[model samples]
Target: MITAQNLTKRFGAHTAVDDVSFTIKPGQVTGFLGPNGAGKSTTMRMIMGLDRPTHGSTTVNGRPFGEHTDPMRQAGALLDAKAAHPGRRAADHLRLLAATNGIARSRVDDVLELTGIASVARRRIGGFSLGMHQRLGIAATMLGDPEVLIFDEPVNGLDPEGVHWVRGFAKARAAEGRTVFISSHLMSEMAQTADHIIVLGKGRVLADAPIAQFLGGAGQERTRVRVSDATVLGSILSADGVSITQTDAESLEIAGLPPAHIARRAALENLDLHELTPLNASLEEAYLALTDDATEYRSDRTAVAA
Candidate 1:
């Protein structure tokens, strides 16, 4: 498990991460989400001991990352895929890391095969594509066979097949009772990949909960109702605190009321109904609602370019 207690980081006058606290439980894939410059990378660096926190602390198990006897075996991280020397061969790079950490050289081949990059194991890093570099980075992380894994933007340059492989790999690790914390900007992928989610904006945590709860727990339930006479049903359904949006001439998107309530209301009014569908708030919707005010950058598009 990974535990962060009031973690904070400051660079001169600017605060990058502000008193953030959260837990990444084992046997689960926890997604770390945020907009650009929202402190996701800063927090991951602090957790890996790459940067010291200005206040509070983050621990892998019960100790800081620097205090671990076998740091790589305890927690492995892929913060930057390009951290290795660009001239070195992929296999040689993994060999060097294993040598420094007293890991057996055989583990190098194991990870190379595991990450599906063994075919190009002898190729130089500079010649590898962005996707190949990502695979090589993941191979390095698995060299330690660590119980806790941290991946920052692991799918940045991956194709569809690679992304699918990563999703399955993360869940497989969690199934083995390992702590897997991944940070990404892709909400649709997170909706399918993560079991729990932590959202950050403006250097602070905005929300953290299970994926299911995070998607539906924040806003009012919306029900889409298409009636035969939306013009007549509009005034009849309009009441105090009940919001209704007319989607079309004959369709209305209703909120602040249950589907059953809308159906009963239509029945009592003797109105014909065509569609009564309950629309669940998607992850993208929930994320936008949560971070609307927290977004640091906003664009005012007053002009269009041809």
Candidate 2:
């Protein structure tokens, strides 16, 4: 277990984390989410004791990270997958970490096997691809068989299969009663994997809730309607509780009306309907809506492209 209590950090005058608090428990995968400048990496650094917080504190289990005996054996962190010495051999790197922590040398090979990097263990890390580097990072994190694991953007450079593998691996670790905390900007990927979510914006915690609650962000129900004569059918259904928007010449995006009521209304008006589907607010849509104000730099690129 890990708890961040009013964790705040500042660089000079700019406050990065703004009194954030959260608990990550074992036996569940918790996803940490925020936009690019939302202070996620800084928070992770504080948790790993790499960055001194300007105020407040974070702890693993019940003790501050700096106070933990055999810190690597207690909590493993991968802040950046490629944050390794480029000249070091992968196997030697793992061995050095294991040696420093008094973890068994055999554990190095075990993690190598666990992360599927045994074949390339002797290769220089500089020659490794991003996917291979991710594998090495995971191998390093598992060197001590730590009970708490933190991964920041673990899936950033992986292919689809690699993404699936990491998702499964994180879930498996949590199943063994170990805490797994993952941070990523991909909401759809997180929605498929995380049991709970913590959303951040403007260096503050915007929302913290279960995955279901977080995924349901500020959007009303929408229904898709298809008809052969969309013009006539849309006018017929546009009576009171329905505002029909043309999806195409033949399809209608209808909202504020139940499917059954829409069908009944269509039937009474003798309309030819073909399809009816509800367009729920997906995790991606929710994330976009949540960060609408934070995307300042994008407007410039969009305008230039326009």
Candidate 3:
């Protein structure tokens, strides 16, 4: 497991990470989410010992990353895809890392094949594409076979197939009881891959809970309904706490009332109900709502001249 307690970081006058704290337990995939400049990368860097925290502490498997005798074997991270030298061959880079970490050279081939880059093992790093670079970086992280895996935008340059592979790989690792922590802007992918979520905003943790709880707590549960007498049914359902939005001439989106209650009310009113479907909030919607105020960069939604 990875733990951060009151973790903080500052660069010059600006604080990047502010008193952040969260626990990434094993046996599950925890997604780290935030808007731009929310200090996610900074927190990951602190955990990897790439940058020193100005205050508080972070640990991997109960100790600082640098304190581990075999750091690579304890925790593996893919912070940057271009960390390897451009002059080195893909296989050479892995061999060098393995040699330093006392890992067998055979393990290099295993990871290269595992990441589906074995065919390009002899190629120079400078000639690799962005997707290939990401695969190579994943291969490096796997060379140690660490129990804790930290990936920062692992699918940044991947294709759809690559993204699917990564999602399955993360889940498989977690199934094996390894701690998997991933940071990505792909909400749809995170919704499918992560079992839990940790949201950061304005350099502080805003939400940390299971995916279902996070979504449920971000906004009220909405139900979509269609009936023969939509206008009259909406009027009957409208109340002090209930919200009813007329989506169309025949349908309505409602909140603050259960489906059973709406059905019962419609039955009592003799309204012909065609549909009553609960709308589960998407991760993107929940993230946007929770971090609405924490977003540092806001883009104008005004339409431009055609």
Candidate 4:
């Protein structure tokens, strides 16, 4: 398990992580979520002993990361997939890391095969694709067969098949009682992969809870309605304390009102309804709503004349 005690990190006057505290338990996959510049990377760096926290502490398996005699055997991370030497062969890269921690050279081939990159293991790193690089990085992380694994954006450059493989692999690892923590912007994947979630905003811990609880509560239910006149339906729903977003000419997504209420309103107004569907609140929607205020780089885009 990984634990953080009021973890705080500051660079000069700029604080990156602020009094954040949480525990990542074993036998479960925990997701780390945050908006850009919300200090997700900084916190992970501190846990890996790459960055010194200005205050507080973090530990892997009950002791500081630096104090571990065999750090690779305790915890392994894949923060940067392209951090390997570009000139080295893929297998050579894993061999180098394994040598540092007294791991057998045979383990290098094992991980390469496990990651499905064994065919390309003899190729130079510089010639690998983005997805191949990610595979190699994952292979290196598993070189020591650590009990704790942390992956940052593991699916960033992967194809659909690769993404599916990672989701299954992470869950399989957790089922084996390993501590698995992953950070990703792909909320849909996280929704499927993680059992629990920890959200950070503005360098503070916004929430830490099970996936179901985190996506539940207020503003959880939203419905989509398809009518002959979406504009009129939107106006009617808006006046009744419902928020409406016109998706297209015939469809409007309504929030703050149940599907039954919407159907009743449509019947009362003699509105021609084609469809009235209850839309599930997705993890993407929840993340955007929770971190709307914490987003660092806000965009203001407007249509331009052709």
lDDT of each: 0.92, 0.87, 0.94, 0.90
Point out the higher-scoring one by TM-score: 1 or 4.
Answer: 1
Report the Cα lDDT for candidate 3.
Answer: 0.94
> Where is model 1 poorest over a 10-residue stretch in terms of lDDT?
297-306
Candidate 1 lDDT score at position 160: 98
Predicted candidate 1 versus true structure: per-residue lDDT over 230-297, tens digit per residue: 87788888988888999788899988888999899899988999999987788889998899888887
Runs of candidate 2 exceeding 4 Å displacement: 225-233, 236-242, 246-252, 258-277, 301-305
Worst 10 residues of 3 by lDDT: 297-306
What's the TM-score of every candidate structure? 0.90, 0.86, 0.93, 0.83
Model 4 steric clash pairs: none
Q: Tell me which of candidates 1 and 2 scores higher on TM-score.
A: 1
What lDDT tens digits, residue by residue, belong to model 4 across residues 259-291? Answer: 998888888889999999886667888888889
After superposition, candidate 1 runs with Cα above 4 Å error: 226-235, 245-252, 266-277, 301-306
Question: RMSD in angstroms, all models?
Answer: 2.5, 2.9, 2.0, 3.9
| TM-score leader | 3
Ranking by lDDT: 3, 1, 4, 2
Evaluate model 3: give its TM-score: 0.93
